[model samples]
Target: MSKGPIAVIVLSHRDSEQVTRLIHRITEGTNSFAVIHHDPSGEPLSIPPSSQVAVIPDPIPCKWGRLSLVQAQWKTLQWVARNVPEFSWALLVSGQDYPIRKMSAIEQELAGSPYDAYLRYFRVGPDPAEDVIPWQALTRRRYLYKRRVPFSRRSVTLPFKRRHPYRNGVELYVGDMWFNLSAPTVAAVLDARQMSERMLSYLRFAPIPDETFIASMTLNVHPAPNVAHDSKRYIKWGRRQLHPQIITAEHLPDLRASDAFFARKIDRLAHPEIPDLLDRLAEERTASSG
Candidate 1:
């Protein structure tokens, strides 16, 4: 497989040290660059200076379950497009995510793959297939009237019906927020976004917009863009869970067997031993490959 340069974009709200470690691991022996986007609302991340890593000076104030999350990703994508044109692929990872395989191996796997984007996706709304996000989620975000207390931390929503965002034959597609995207795919989505304010407004009001925005841009377009139903990240989404299962030492065996490039949602404060084990695994993998 012919290797090409890759740019790893790390979106972090906390855990600066871990993010730096991740950058070091990726840049140790590979032709790759790291772009760190830290949310300004979180604790200030003290990322060590590195020739291979660039941190965004003005980070977005990302909010949970809001359009701000998608805004942060938009900023990161724009930064990569303007600053790292040499990279053929852009991989988005969170601070909690750590690589499971050697950088060389990841590059080799991507080099031979046919898909332009490695992301999990499914159609949503109007009698969607199984596993797709139900229409209720979309309705709650877009159609229902939500009322919030001025100072209290409580809100209420009233059920209602309004126009679905998908207009003029445009279909809604939802997927995992993390993705590994090719240059062409990124360019296409950004270009379309710049040209369409209606699409932007529609997605901004949609529920969990981060999960739907990019998927809609690429998958809904004509000629159906090249996409693969895999993110190459080991994430366990348990039943009725709002987020992925937190990774711990108990999951090490499954992580090793996954053959994924990275695993997600790790928190050192909650599971201190897990990161140590993962660090050991990374070291062993790198040494063996070397």
Candidate 2:
């Protein structure tokens, strides 16, 4: 049976070159459409000619940790919905991320499944008690530095005062930022009324709004039988930290067992293991299919 088309959206700030490289690697032999959301960094971008690229106009005098990134994502989603025809699934990815599985295997698994792979939540609330430290809450604060406008202390206040989707006294769990979503779920997210307000509010104060927006919105609109509980991307958290540790070749065995389509936070310069990891995944996929 012929597999359906998949649209991969890669989000990045100033890493156009890395985004292009990832596009080349992941879409090498697949029927996939790629959209790269260039963060409003004031530099020229080198986009691949083979892939579709959308340069989101950076808002002048942009502030860090603002809603611009989320806006860019929304724009990219609209672009895909309008321009890309016949896509069955949409995979949200990052420029810093790489695929750990072969295209064929990912296609095979997705083709046979009706579910979307993403974290979901019904409500928003305080972050878990354990997640309040500098490592968890302050890592992305770098983005908030060097703002054109003076930082407002009030703006830094907590974004989620309460857990999301708080219906029937059930506290909803937030999903990961990265997700593989079905087309229908994507449509629902774009159409949701709370997307703009909640996302914008969350972006201002939340250390990582990307992790929560889709998860909460998806659950609120389309409660799953369709959503996948776990993200299929392999991420390794650093020692006593919230963010994924930088990935390297030594992680190949773990990647293989992860059953994940992609892995993140790859170090492009010093990581010699990337090529080997990709080759092994391709070989194993071929062997499995044969």
Candidate 3:
């Protein structure tokens, strides 16, 4: 879209092959740079070398629902800001994510878009608030007693309750962690993190802080266009479920019809046909563009 290269930051703690396929799909026919933040303690990453792809040198030991998850994402943004400044947009995808549309089409659209970010966010608790289960979870800092190592196979969450920590004026916004951000927005977010020690310290114990960290930071920048609060990722979060549903071939028709640039929770082992289907769809989009 912008005729400029895009940076793809992938945070993965799962299978390396899936991560590799995700990287390949993103790099196929687009001018992009990809950086993978592999979980240092998870399955080893073994993707073949390509100039467009880089695995974070000091991979964070990412733990689910822990501050480490947010740190890993931050580290990726820091890497991009310092090393890949030429790119205008940074699309955050997970290892199990796959391109729904052609990479070229995504590039062309983003290149032309006026918005600084493509993400969705809402205040965690409004006075006449939009009520959701995560509302209470986010506003209250429960992790102090309930925290557990996110990626640890044997880790267990210790349950406890505490009063909500007072936020004098700090606001918490929640949204999907994955997003597409313009370079300026990315830089702004990084800068905010560096400057906001109080906010960071507060969120460190906040439940699922990854969902709130970047989404909340976007609110700090000016010009509404710069905070385009729409994260164009296709994920189905079922009620009471800790994770989104894994994508399968049954969603093929929906995947083709939707405008989302990418879809997530696709496990190659569970639905091996899905990657090929996405590949074919990507090729079709590329052909049509040509």
Candidate 4:
């Protein structure tokens, strides 16, 4: 295993202060560092200089539910892998994510994990015999032909009629985009087969391609390596609109008990105490470990 630090790729489009704080939180007590990909058109960011953090210059302009988001993330990761030699692992998280556990322990767990990846990846198909979930409308909407009704606000997905079912020969997979990838799995994703011309061609017009691109690419390998379906993240999308429920102080009990290493969609400005509570939890872990 590589003895290098964990690399955290952060997609920050807003709230520079919160993003800056998040970078420090993830790297404060661990060797892990952060690469911030702030949107080129978003709010200007001012973060303190640190050896543990670097910001990608001119982050691609990303539109939600568009291919640009996926492209920016993939390119940022590739750049990091080439620049930061032998990183033990790399994880993708948003600027809104905060560690629910100690960063050092989180890094240790990933560094020692047997699984090559920790993300929610499952095949989407109608065949039950293949251990795939029933075909989902959302899946169809994402993969099938869709025209973006641009010039609104964020990219909107009004999928065209099922028309030609987008299928890559039973290899279609879907999952949340956030994930942690070991060095080998990272290399596998970077392989020519995974980042192929065909895959890019298909994803160019697909809705929310970022959610499917990495999962479809990484999980389609033959003799797939052990992959934990758990993303080790706590995010609640319970019957809400587009945005997830913002974590509040009331969620402390759940946060304390969850196995998740990180939680997202948290507004630190709104729930400032949340971080202090998490910091206490980390201290409690340290105390217990001691």
Please report the candidate that would top TM-score against the real structure: 4
Question: Using TM-score as the measure, what is the rank order of every candidate, best first?
Answer: 4, 1, 3, 2
CA shift at 273, candidate 3, in angstroms? 1.1
TM-score of every candidate: 0.85, 0.75, 0.85, 0.88
RMSD over all Cα atoms, model 4? 3.1
Quantify all predictions' global Cα lDDT against the true fold.
Answer: 0.74, 0.62, 0.74, 0.76
| Superposed Cα deviation of residue 283, candidate 1 (Å) | 5.2
Give candidate 2's root-mean-square deviation (CA, Å): 5.6
Candidate 4 lDDT, 131-234, residue by residue in tens = 54443445754566354444543334553553332354536778878988887778777874534556777666665677787787778654575789988888
Candidate 4 matches the true fold with a TM-score of: 0.88
Candidate 2 Cα lDDT to native: 0.62
Q: Candidate 4, overall lDDT?
A: 0.76
Error of 4 at 205 (Å): 1.9
Tens-digit lDDT track of model 2 for 163-258: 323345323335566767777777777777654465456345554455555665667564543776678888888677756788877787787777
Which ranking of candidates, highest lDDT first? 4, 3, 1, 2
Question: Each prediction's Cα RMSD?
Answer: 3.4, 5.6, 3.8, 3.1
The window of 10 residues in a row where model 2 has the poorest summed lDDT is: 141-150
Task: After superposing candidate 3 on the true structure, give the runs of residues whose Cα lies further than 4 Å from its correct spot.
Answer: 1-3, 129-169, 193-195, 223-225, 286-290
Candidate 1 TM-score to native: 0.85
